[model samples]
Target: VSVCAEAFNPDDDDEEDTEPRVVYPKSDDQRARLQEACKDILLFKNLDQEQLYQILDAMFERKVEPTEHVIDQDDDGDNFYVIERGTYDIYVNKDGKPLLVGKYDNHGSFGELALMYNTPRAATIVATTEGALWGLDRGTFRRIIVKNNAKKRRTFETFIESVPLLKSLELSERMKIADVIGERSYQDNELIISQGDQADCFFIVESGEVKIMIKSKTQADQQEKTEVEIARCTKGQYFGELALVTNKPRAASAYAVGDVKCLVMDIQAFERLLGPCMDIMKRNIVNYEEQLVSLFGTSLDLENPGI
Candidate 1:
């Protein structure tokens, strides 16, 4: 069921609670199944192996009989559940009438929306058949998932704010960008993108530097193309957008200058979040072309003219 967000009120008492962490006993089979189920979840994608194991350890198993109301709409969220076996139906209370909105049977999960946003449970989940589920308590979910996600958002937001290209975006829009973008690290001299490849994503340097290069075929019969370094993108600078914006092949190759980390957003996100800045980006393309002319003196073979 679809639900909207509400302001999260962090409980002052929960902040200071020193109660020992709760860990439920699980058989080896149960642990293995939970691990497999969690592997494909977006919420757990950023978690390291150790953190993943911690989540597994904290989950308890619950067996439900047919017609059991596992979660009720409008109640405060307490546990997030991962389906292990059998079928369930999701119901939403619309205008005092219960409507069946969806169903889950496989390894699907629910109740996290409430926990993550501090809203009431928006849907009621009822067991259609006897089923088993692994549940993680509210405190554990916040400690592991909420805490790490907040830290990551703050880190990405800081780098995004430093980018001149995105300065025109509102704070809320920038925060939305931060939420969907992802991070990747590259070793020294690792190729981030190759010249002439189709552009699918844009990059923003989070740390270290990215070396920009362009390839040129000096002679008609030459089999090898000469690659020349054009620029170095330091922290907060961005690359790989020219091709994406122009809908052409990458104009230059990007390589990690050292141990480097970058924030990446796919073409879809670039168009969605940065759509308003298109005119600004188009203007900057001309400025980039001028810079290239000054650097080479003669025109380089930039079929698409981008970086």
Candidate 2:
């Protein structure tokens, strides 16, 4: 019997141990950390715990390598990524050299513009170290941020509160404006409005600040130059109101002071909702008239009601 048992054992010493070994599935702690960290990100902020868990389940254990290019300038931006670990550098081509624009570390994010419109990548981003990143494609990201229940409306309202131009609007009018507005967020120094460009939309600041620069003609040989800032916009301030009323070129350029969030409404939408309402028009006219009367009294041209 001993001889037969020995013959059955391929390796005698190895077979001597009969205890079973415990095996554990990979820990979900990393995923939990990521979900918790991303809670404040633009697309994930409004999601509840249960909704966040669902998102975590769909996005676990994803990883990226050091020096990997997360995005390239001019590429079609179709994905948004959140860094769970490590760092990344944003670069732009200047004079045939890659100029470093900024660095993003843990909890940093990029690629949001893809969710709003199909715009080209504004800068190239490369992972500076081995990192874990969570990715949401354009379609999925939009479904969460723009298509989810009441999220878009709430975000638009939040944005409207930041612009000064919209400050005079009543709640009912604000809601009407919110229905047609779009929200956007940009990093520090990003250009929100370019001078001389045809203005298609008006913007309301939601968070952060912006600097305005105007183009002017100098007396020195009639040379055109940019004028110093005539206005600085902060939260609850609005710009480009004139653009919504008239399809004219932008009078000034607006650049992000830090990170900025804005609510933008196209001229067509503005005209459709707020322009035709005689009551609203009359109310605005009266408000403006009252201000003028306070400043200039009866000498002001009060006959033109639309001003």
Candidate 3:
């Protein structure tokens, strides 16, 4: 099935209330409660106030009685919930038996991963007491958050079109890749990738710059082994594709020159969506490595590109 937000059409013809009415939290005190309830959710933690408001505006309150199944394993995830009151029991099937694996008390959240990835519920969550919940429906979450992410991704794809190695991809092919690529940020002086490490993710700098370096022999006058810079990368530049295609160690390290943001895709994503290009690079590995060395000298030694 195509990747998108979960289907959110609730059946209205059923006699009994299968779904509860949504009540939005108003007033700063209440929204503050909603914000506090979401403190532990890493996905929502980075969201700014405006973004948080969007989600809150689209949410509704759900009242549940004791022993009610708030979510069932393998069910299509319809909503993401935050506990405003009471507790819940989380269960997952193990060896054909339902096992209680976790619990969510006041201010706990469940069903976020499903909404983020459009996957089926992995665990069942049952209300353990008469309580209330704040929920964002699938459609609303997609409209407010997922759609914004999609827009950002398209912008990144446009930027990727100018990359040296990826420039050859057809617009449609690149668009496929845009769907799976993820973003990351780094603080100034932070390490982006280390030399001699097994590389699993390829990256393209989206903003700011990173310095390329290689570990060198300890300085004669100093006891420490300092990395020497060989190249500097800026927006629209990419690295680590060599390791993705060859499954080899990184030949050089990268450290953020300042605050940096990058578009990243893991090896699996590269292979699945952009696999054909992998072989092309592998077949001409020698020439490609040489070209890179020419582009970014290794340890200030052009001959020792270190690939």
What is the TM-score of each predicted model, taking all chains together?
0.57, 0.43, 0.48
lDDT (Cα, tens digit) per residue for candidate 3, span 1-307:
5444435322222324333434465877777777677655434533568777667776777899999999999888889887899888889889989998656666556675566567788788999999888888976665545545555555667677877667777876676566557678999999888777876777889899988876654355125656667667799877677666655677778899889998887554565457656655665556645655574453343223333
> lDDT of each structure?
0.79, 0.60, 0.69
Lowest lDDT 10-mer window, candidate 2? Answer: 2-11
lDDT of 1 by residue, 201-267 (tens): 7898989999988876456423576787878899888888899778789888999988999888766
Relative to the unseen true structure, what is the C-alpha lDDT of residue 290 in candidate 1, on a scale of 0 to 100?
Answer: 80
- Candidate 2: where is the Cα deviation over 4 Å? 1-27, 149-162, 165-307
User: In candidate 1, what residue range of length 10 has the lowest lDDT sum?
Assistant: 4-13
In model 3, pairs of residues that clash are: 22-60, 23-60, 23-61
Model 2's lDDT to the true fold?
0.60
Clash pairs (backbone) in predicted model 2: 162-236, 163-236, 163-237, 163-238, 164-236, 164-237, 164-238
TM-score of 3: 0.48
In candidate 3, position 300 carries an lDDT of 42
lDDT of 2 at 186: 89
Each model's backbone clash number: 0, 7, 3
